[model samples]
Target chain A: MNPPILEIRHLDLQLGGFRLADFNLEVAGGECVALMGPSGCGKTTLLETICGLHRPAAGTIHLAGRDITHLPPGTRGIGLVPQDIALFPSLTVAEQLAFGPKLHRWPPGETRERVLSLAKALDLTSLLGRGLHGLSGGEARRVALGRALALRPRLLCLDEALSGLDETLHGEILAVIRDAIRREGVTALHVTHSSAEAAAIADRVVRMQARVPDAGERDLTANPPNGRWRHRSSGPPPGPEVGRC
Target chain B: MPSSPPAPSHPWRTRPELPFLLFLAAVLLGYLGLLVALVAANILTVSPAQALEVLRNPDIIHSIRLTFFTCTATAALSVLIATPIGYLLSRFRFPGRMLIDTLLDIPILLPPLVIGLSLLILFNRITPSSCCLVLGGTLALATLVGWLAVLPRSAPPAPAILTTLGLVSLTLLATAWFTRHSTASLETLAGDRFGLPMTFQPLGIVLAQLPVAAAFAIRTLRTTFDQISPRYEAVALTLGCNRGQAFTRVVLPLAGRGVLAAGTLAWARALGEFGPVLVFAGATRGRTEVLATSVFLEINIGNLPGAAAISLMMILLAVAVLLLVRLFAGNPPPSGQ
Candidate 1:
């Protein structure tokens, strides 16, 4: 059996005031995992840490079965589309799609072919030579996806990539993403606030809660504090901590 | 409240940009009033007979010709110097960049008299004014030693013009060659980099204005690029631009207007700079004399009518040049573009 492409073990990251602690995640190859958390909950931080844009205070990242916690983002073969879709200003659609592959010394003809196919799929065939400044939000998001997938990366970490899309375009984008993940078979970690997103595509769901103020070294003890909880089909209410997001 | 002054009603007060307009008006009136008063006084003093006499003076004609000739040459040289320097400062980061920026402002802020003295110190210090008696004293005043004590460009200059220009040209040629070689190697080893091509290099007069003009260019471009949503670049990168391709194609196009404005404004400033010309090149009548020197000498000689004529001419020329620049730089953009 082929192994899972990405594995995260108890990732812990602290940056000034915000902290992501007791973080554990795993995505089987060809699997899409949607990360959910409240505002200021470090969902994006977790993505950045995995993609090597940030560091986890304590964590282990295994990509394609090789540990890559300390590797630079460029060397890790992990592609990220930040929430803002950080594209370089001076490059065009086609050039944007080729950035990483060129960095890794991909052959020109193959890179060009890959870019063309990717462009065709993203409805960007007409937009290949066009500069990116004038594109609509939905169009920009699609281009971001194309660039990430162009490298044929083993892992794609998307951080709230649809924050600015309209409802109709959002559905179209979601569909495109589903088809893209299947066609590419890359392990994907998608962060969003919507549970509908997780239910739509995730093979398994893992819920994360923001660290509470003054909580010392993770309160792993179960049933220590008596708490009134709301029912969830006969389960206790997720209460303040778990359901807040 | 005793019958307020009808809320100071005017179309200007109610306009969306009214406050800014009023602020600009007050500043303009305050600073320009003295200059306007002086011009009015000169015009009042000019009689028809005196004006005709002033117009016929040969010395006045010579001074006017000399001043403009200097301004044009100096401006051309300044522009030649500023372009690459601006590009380098803006696009690259290296040691002493801040110091270079500060050094440039020295000429901009220093008084003309101090500038002249600085030039003297730079050149004549080595020649020891005693040697001025020999070598025809013409060579002494016409070149480095003269400007060293009296100019900004030559002051603190590391080498004389002869030595400096030849060395700078060689360095520029070598750099161009090196850049070409590296680009070729990179394309062979790692193809399709988007970094800017070497053909954009500035020349001659443009190079002379490299410091201030380039500084302005870099600031304009950097700010423009910064304001652009980098999300676009990231998206394009993900699409496939490789770092080089992404920037050239995506980011630069997005910032094209800003780049154009920066280039034009730098060119305009390079065209106007005067102090450096006077000290570095001297008022050698038609060689280094520019608009400011032409006006200065004519006014100082008590030839009010002649001075007014040339002053009006210089101002008109400046206006024409600025109009051409504005076609590219646009209406000052309210943000000093």
Candidate 2:
């Protein structure tokens, strides 16, 4: 009962036709969770609402114990790894790492030291001078991760963060991320449709069924659940982010 | 890894009307050469030094300097002010945006002289600002500053200066209008009638040019935006950078060259603005006499050599500026496009 690091309760995001109805989630401090759902099952909308990018039509989202429902994304200390790995093309790898702290007006010396350390840790020390013109998929993802980590966010939301990564690099990235999380005690909510990724990275997984209109839908809660799922007293934990729409 | 041999060149796969590029270049060069030859035939032969002596006449130099000073000042002012307007036009949608966009092009399409007349009719003897009595006084320098043309006969240089400066401003405005490259009959658009002192006055030239420069800058900025990728912005925002910081750190760097090109084009358009300056600022011998107006004067009033010499100087100055622009315009951060 460490204050829930992230929480979404009875959320209803009305995006025209589809409604993300009855969505409830919570992640404990220093814990990781995975959200497994189909393509259009409101996974992204949920994450965006958590990140304060989208406003829920009828719901409350508590992040780090603050009611951040109406806050802009920048005010909330949630880091998002979008699906497309939206790295700034105009910046060099090093500049990308410096982007966040520079905006927050951190001391230049500390920012520089942090950038160098992160570059070395991420194996981007040599690529410091490299411009972000045409990066291989893996390199871009790492740069993107470094950019997110620069903010030192309380929660890391990865929206299909590993989708574009090559298989060979995927294991390594996951391992790097796992180690970083353990070292920093940062909470993560990873979103993906891939079971292999869930099995590899998630401590626990929540199953999400597509929220179709309940005109004649069956009550899923009445039946014994088919797949293996561990339920929290409140609900499931937050997961990875979706690409910014 | 050894590089694979180059893939066989596509025979028909890559055809994209590219052959027309060289044809376009050739046609442009040939036309330019023909124009140069025509100018050469029209002028009396004179050495560069003799031409310099003729130019050394205080009267001629004064006229030339007035043209240079006014046009340069007007153009510079127009460009600096127009950038934000241009950026807004391309990026944002608001009420009256379309009307303002259309209104900006009027001075450019109409002859500079007509604009000057309209501006004059609006301002002095009628416009409230003109009722202030400052414009009508002899010390107002109406010929030089140009809002009041009621004293058109007091100075030999007032009308001509008004026409030249007016035309320069109008053309600057026109260049801005055309830069958008919209197929909307850009010229046929009329503006709100404030009956301001801009028309029929040298100020009209400045006024005329201001909107045109804005239009061109808008077009330039639009093209710049088209080449940018939002991925960079996405990255910065996710990294805790706000919109302003992200724009400065990410968008501007990659768009630097394009931005530079826009500014340079705007400046060049300002410098060479002629038709509007001719009609609005007028072809006065010493008042609003820009290079183009001087050329016009020499051709019409027996100073062919002076006109040719001034034209040549203008060409050299323009080439120098064009060269400077090219040199610096190639270094912006790589576009994700």
Candidate 3:
């Protein structure tokens, strides 16, 4: 059997006072896993660490069966769609989509074709010429997703993928996301707080608990049990059965 | 009750406040007019031809060249240095970050002459290499300590405090030991070591202007960096940009206008830097004499027309710079509230 597309073992990451320890997970090739946790849990941090933004204090991260623990984000072959939909304000949607491909030294024609295909997929065809500043939140999110998918990444990490949207729009975007992931055949690790979001697009679900207690909790100074809070599998994914639009 | 006849309109309630606004406007205009009138009076006393003649004077021309070039250099250097410093202050959260930020503002609040004097004293007492050594050592040590404190788990408070004190003492000792051999003043040392005159040299003028100019640049760029969302850089990173590429492609392009605006403001401030220049770089006939000191020299020598000509030149230059900055930066967007 092929090794998992993205594998993390015994990951320990600390940013400031917050600590995420002994994290272990694996996603098989082309699998979509939903990581749901409460606020202040290490969901975003783990996504970042996998993307090579944060260095793990301990443990190894493997992509395509190769250790990429010390690799820079640019070389990680992992695309990230952050919660804020951080579209580059200075670039048109077309330029934004082309950015990754161009950086990877793709030929002009190929880059343009890829950008156009992604734009079409994400319903960003009309807004390709528009700067990000004037985009509506929904449009911005779509463009951001398109940008992340432009490089045809081996792994895609989504932080709060269905957040800050109305319920109606959420279902629409999730359908688009599911279709795109299937088309690209990319492994995905989606982080969201909503259980419905987890059920809609994931083949499996996992949960991480906050290692540090919330502010004003009794055990402020006390270390977390066994140097980890929780890394429990929350059962199988429902796979887009939750009121698909 | 007939709604009390709809209530008679009070004068204050019905008024447009035009009179009050006009009064404030008059005060504002009067203050501006006072400056214009003074400059105008000076221009009036000197004919166009006389001003042209003053401009043609070799000494005055030299001063103008020195002023323009040094101020430009100061602005460029400051902006170059401030970009990374401002970025770090805006993006990173380390211990004593606030303290570093407050220290950046010291030159701005300091009297200009004091800034010059401080530089003068520093150069006089400490060799440049010595100064650099002490500063570099402290920074490297502090960063090492900071990293060790945070990473591998936070260190206990007692060791951290003791480590900080130890580093500080070591730095002080190093600085003192380095300065011990430098008995000669900056002027004498420069003449002996480099055979370049320190006082009244154009280089001294740049050194004097740097503190004030860099303070302004740092502050302006810090505000610019603060206004920029860090997520833009993050997006760039995830889009296959390394740190340098992310800054150059994403952050720099977004901040282009702010950088231009900050450079213009710093250049203007440096152009008008008089007190520091006077203290560090003395006013000589041709060398080290800038437009500000030229005006001072002319006034001292009872050359009213000459001073007036220089004043008019400065005003014209200031207006030109303002126009250029407006053209490039587009009014700076009212800064973040």
Give candidate 3 regions above 4 Å deviation: A1-4, A7-10, A21-28, A36-42, A90-94, A106-113, A116-140, A161-172, A193-199, A204-245, B1-58, B121-198, B304-309, B312-316, B319-337
1 or 3: which has the higher TM-score?
A: 3
Tell me chain A's TM-score in each of the predictions. Answer: 0.83, 0.84, 0.87
TM-score of chain B of each: 0.48, 0.59, 0.79
> On residues B1-337, what C-alpha lDDT tens digit does candidate 2 reach at each position?
9999876586434456456766788999999999888657635465677688767967678766665565555556655655455545554443345666776776566665575555444443242323223323322332235535324323322354456545655555455445444322211122233433333344545554454554565566666755565555655665666666767776776666666666666656665666656655566665556666667777787866777787777777778767866765655434442
lDDT string for model 3 (A179-214, tens) is 988889888999988877777788777777654555
DockQ per model, Cα = 0.22, 0.25, 0.37
Instruction: Compose the digit string of candidate 1's lDDT tens values, residues B1-337.
Output: 6775665456576778788998999999988998778666666766667667654666556645654443344444443454344434444433345766676566556664465445444433433222223333333233444345325433222234334444544554454445542423321222135542211111112223334445555555555555556445444443444445556665566656666666555655654555544454454443344455556666777766666765555555657766765675453311200
TM-score of 1: 0.59
lDDT of 2 by residue, A88-188 (tens): 76568998889788878899999999899888777789899998766777777787777777778888888888886678889888877766666657788
Which stretch of 10 consecutive residues in model 3 chain A shows the poorest summed lDDT?
A: A236-245
Model 2 alpha-carbon drift over 4 Å, by segment: A1-4, A9-50, A53-58, A82-95, A107-113, A125-140, A159-171, A189-199, A203-245, B1-79, B86-208, B230-242, B248-250, B312-337
Cα deviation at B25, candidate 3, in Å, is 8.7
| Ten contiguous residues with the weakest lDDT in model 1 chain B | B196-205
lDDT per residue (tens digit) for residues A1-245 in model 1: 24668878777666545555556565667777676655555667677778765666676989988999977566677778788776654568887787767766889998899999999888899999988669877777788889888888898888887777788988888888777877887878888877766666555445555333344544422321221111111122132222211
| Candidate 3 clash figure, as a count | 1
Native contacts kept, each candidate: 0.34, 0.45, 0.62
